[model samples]
Target: MKLILKACIILIILSNTAIAQRLYNTSEKLWKPQKDEAFLQEIATTIPTNEPVVSVAETNETCFALMSGNIYALKSGKLNKDNSAPAGVTELKNKNGDIWALTDNGIFRFQNDRWKKIDDKKYVDLCMHAGKLHAATSEEIYRLEGDRFVTTKPENGYYSSNMTMLMEDGTQLHDDPVRLGPISKIESYSGTLYVLRPGKLVLFDGLIVNEDFIDWGLLPSKNTRDMLSFGRRLFISTDRGMGVLQGAALKTIKGEEGLPVENTTCLERGFDQDIWIGTERGAVRMLKDEWHYFGADMWLPDNKVNDIAVGNNVVYIATEGGLGVINFEPFTLQKKADFFERHLEEWGHKRLGFIHTVYQKDGEWVREISDNDGGHTAPYLAAMCYKYAVTGDPEARKEAVESFNAMLFLEKVSPIDGFFARSIWSTTGDKDEMGRHGSGGLPAKWYKTADGKWYWKGDTSSDEVTAHFYSVSLFHDLVAKGKEKEMAKQHLEKIAAYIIDCGYTLHDMDGKPTRWGRWDPEYLLRPYGYVDRGVNGLEALTFMQTAYNLTNNKKFDDSYNQLIKWGYAANTIRQKNVFPPENLAPWDDNLAFESYYTLLRYEENPALRSTYLRSLERTWEVKRMEHISWFNFAYGAITGNDCDLEQSIKHLREWHLEPIEYNFRNSHRDDLFVEPGYTSYEGGLKAISPREKNITRGSRNAVALDGGQNGRRIMEPTGFIRDYWMARYHGFLEAPETNDPELTSVKRRTEQQFGAEPYKGLEKPVFY
Candidate 1:
């Protein structure tokens, strides 16, 4: 029934197709302080195994621990191996309540409480499928036909022991017995059979041996010990850490993601659907909620784990020390209070309680509060606004108050009316290195204030404006009460009133609008200001709405309506009409999210809501990869359109866990289609071609980290504290799933904040 051929096709060596591995200097100093305490503190104890454990298996009644070359049965918390127990056992199995062992000497079956020798010949593995016994050796697969083991033949073509890796150009590399080692592992999934050889995966559908294959070298260590599938992803364990394969992409998770080392030994899927890994150093369990690590001296004895098996609530680990068992639960707290408190106090605080970006100088982490201080700090302030507005957590309220007061210092210290400085620094006579980004200072966009003792950045962009207004609006409506609330209202009025009084343009002391701070009729109506008009006009409208919302000022409404009547609303919509492959740039999306937040505040107006919702949807679709949690949660709160709750959480996790700036390259992959030309100004724009690049990204993206700092590293990541609480506030991602009592569902996770929405009677803490 099987067809045999002497030789066949050419080997195709595909280039540029490689798996992703990222490196981060976490122990060193960087832009932010990501202690990963939540990721760290969850570690359970590591048990010591006195013997060298090489393999492990769990049967219904007993657990088998293979150490050195002896098969030991773990019972009553004690390990006992028979003196005649098969030595050099490669793997142990409890098949359907039947104890079986695969050793180099022979295949043995245990029955009636004792080992019964079944076959004297050697075998690699033993498995039963469709009520038939099957065994695999290095070069051949055997099936039981009645009493005799027979070689199972392929239906259409003979699976020859000899195989060739054919190149695309008709060249075949013939190394039959050299590099093409025996089948190490095999598994059947759906209707396809996957066989793992020494350096390649041969997949068959029982009929044809497909030409498609994966490069084994693509693995982090390529010393792949074993593999299994959970959900839609394949879990691969190698000499290095762990890996997950979904579709065409392979993501290698290493030490940066809480992994202690890269030398991984074994892997198994937990009863609770978690991924359990065994390594030379310690054992790791990737729970749905968090990554759990077990260190040798920390709790583990011997430190080297050879095999892992999970039963119900306990993890049975086979280690060189003997055996280690761990009991772990998922970290399921909805609020990350510790992360917020620690990080905000450590890296976010600037001079006089203001917010500033933090980075490392030498070995110490320092908050660079004076560099684009307004832009970096605003995201944090907004996050706190959502926190206080929703939960009324006193800590959030206190931080918000501190941030608000610091922002006020920006205006008070400036001699120019209503002009807020980018940041403040101790008045040194030399040029403040705050604005000196890469090459030089921010191109004359800075000036010393009236006092020689202070300096503030000039030519401020609209990014700072929206951040200040947005945070102030949230504080006014949510946290600040009475006089403090009135202060926020006063601040909003002065900023809005200044813009309106100056013909809808933010004018500097030079009596000229900043380069990107113009929305007056002269700029919006002029042809030269086309690019600025669409975005600026949109921003100014939102700014007015925030002012009106906070102060209930009629003039803010009048100013907002005047722009609508002037056709800037329609113009704004047209200007932001990005579709398909053409997406919103990063800065533009930032502006759009800020615009969405402020515009959606006065949702009582149906017509205005309709106008902005369309633009928001387009922006959300295009910028989905950005995974702005606050933006995503805000949208989910207002519209309930899933901006990908799970991936949104993954994005936040990546920020919290690995905040390094690893370079991502799109030039190589064959699976992704490339969009040619002119989308972005710098570097290159590579979109997911065949289909437009939307938001189907996981923690790993199309971008691959090539070991170095690819671009600017960020200190203040935007999501986490704000968006997470917002999702909870909006009643989107609340209540744990009954099936999985732990871990937030990334895919279905959902959110809110700002304004007094009658509080919904949610619990609140005293802010005093």
Candidate 2:
């Protein structure tokens, strides 16, 4: 049988080469946190209003909003007109289990869906203090006494000749008499009624107002917008930043303290132990020591926040355009993986086992026939490889095999032996709207297959080759078995042998080296390829090392030694280029890391290993600031050293749930610190979290100050899936301490919801 002959050939090759295979320990369950665990996922839903909403108040039953001189109640994510609400209402509040509305005619309370006049006098603000309703007019404050308003006078003895304006450090400033301008707002905190007047703060202790207590010197700005009392601290939102008053000590939370924007608009206490601060451009939640920002457009219909109200686990923000509701539900990284995995099928991103990103065409999702289909799908294939190795899930192996075959098909469908296509198009499908031009405007060579059924693109770049070896090597070591294992070995062997045969260049039918596919010493030693010599050399050696390790072929081992003899090893000493500022690109990092992982993993020669390790260390040091998750994970897995795992985990957690590529501009943020000019390259010294901006991949610049697709494309989540699963497999992360069952079932629920519609277009051949 063919199996017997293949076994004999492999034995002969192993005996001849005598190369010991060093493989990853896939069965080893080193630690947890490698698997996905349940956590809370924040979902933003925008509720549009007919008119600009002014204020919001939450009751035990529902939330009520005042809009255009009418009141509306929020129920089931909709606003219904409350006809019973009194006309000319200006403000609404929940006081003593009743809905109180401040109207032009008078003050009214709603009980059993009927409005009743509570007071005939209009008040500027109302608050509950010491189990009594307190109302404020322009000049005086009143308290309710048996359904009647009574004035509260200032205490006679507490008055002083001069008001002291002392700084937080107890520095005294000259002051004038106790002059309260007019009571504009009143709030209760720590058993004292603090009334807000223009530039003055008067305190009332049950009996009378203590007019001498005025907040002035410590405030960041005189024009304050909102005030809130949360957890022994009084927060005042102003145009500059938030001023915190904690037991006479004053501090500020501006750009330095992680406030996304300085000009705050409103503030409210959260349903839990947190505070919500609304800004001119977004909303921020301060929980303990962390800040979560929900930016405009992505999280709200408008940027100007008018008010905020908390209802259970949801926070309703009243923006200028409408109400922005944020709901918190349990979710986990594993659940996210499940969602993306299903998304590939439901969104029709997978075609013939090749994954493509989606873009809207005529209001429907259409697959983008991209040039780097092989390169893009590499992470997904590797993810399935790690997923199968970690969980021993048969489904993971099934998906992995299918994608691997698709990668193999790239070479199989090509005209030249060992040459692979960047992507393929079926003549049976609709015409290729993507056109035949590479990213750099080079003429793309699309050759018809002998069967006249498929058109395979030629002139493959180093990008595709690097991704191919990286992914297939992982499949061979982790997922392949029996015949599939042999197939993986042969696939790598042919590709490695072809480069050697063509003098270290991928030659097309014209017998010329394709652009960016040359790795020969003649090309590398030339001035044109001087900057590329490092990464290209590393990539060349990786192919030989991977092939020899997997196939035990002496030719690959011989070729590997020849490349080392040509000073390629020394070229890799500083593999990452930093000299020419323009050459400093993130895509090189992706290519180098992929090559370094394979070469270092399988190269047993101590000298080469040492040289590659040095290169990896230097490269990771430069990349650590970006907190690029894949690079961090690859470094940790290969080096077994601290790779800033915590920051990488934070980066992963901050990946936006909505994967749409929306434009983001962060150049105006005050917290940015650009690095030295030699290395800055329009990148911040510290990388911004993904939640604050657009989704990024390893090939794309993660630290770029500003850029996006403006919602024209949807980035595939395969990169995230790959990094997370790799972390899981390599023990960089551990299993979560607790897992919520409800959160864990999110994948199942999502599949049921969106898995119904069949994918459009002609069904291509299934690689599996």
Note the Cα lDDT for every prediction shown: 0.57, 0.76
Write model 1 residue lDDT over 163-192, tens digit each, in one string: 455456843444432221267765554334
Q: Candidate 2 lDDT, tens digit per residue, 1-768? A: 999977866664443222112343223322233444455567778787657778887777578887887888888888988997788888777667777888766888777767889888888777788899888776667888976889775542223323354456843333433433377677787777776665445665643346545443466776777777676877878888888866556577788777777889888888779899888877888888767777766777777788888878888888888888888776667666676676666656677777777776666556677888899889899999887776666688889998998898888888677998988887766333545697479988888878877777888889999999999988987878788888888888888899999999998878899988899988998999988899999999899889998888899989989999998988998878876667786788999999987887787767777899898988888777777789988887676677777777877777767667766766666556532322443344547667777666568566675776766677787888898777767767665555565554343334442311333444444433
In Å, residue 622's CA in model 2 sits off its true spot by 1.8
Against the hidden reference, what TM-scores do the models get? Answer: 0.56, 0.87
State the TM-score for model 1.
0.56
User: Candidate 2, residue 271: CA error in Å?
Assistant: 2.9
Best candidate, TM-score? 2
Alpha-carbon deviation at 176 in model 2, angstroms: 13
Off by over 4 Å in 1: 1-329, 333-337, 346-351, 362-364, 427-432, 437-444, 449-452, 552-555, 577-583, 603-606, 621-628, 640-656, 662-714, 735-768
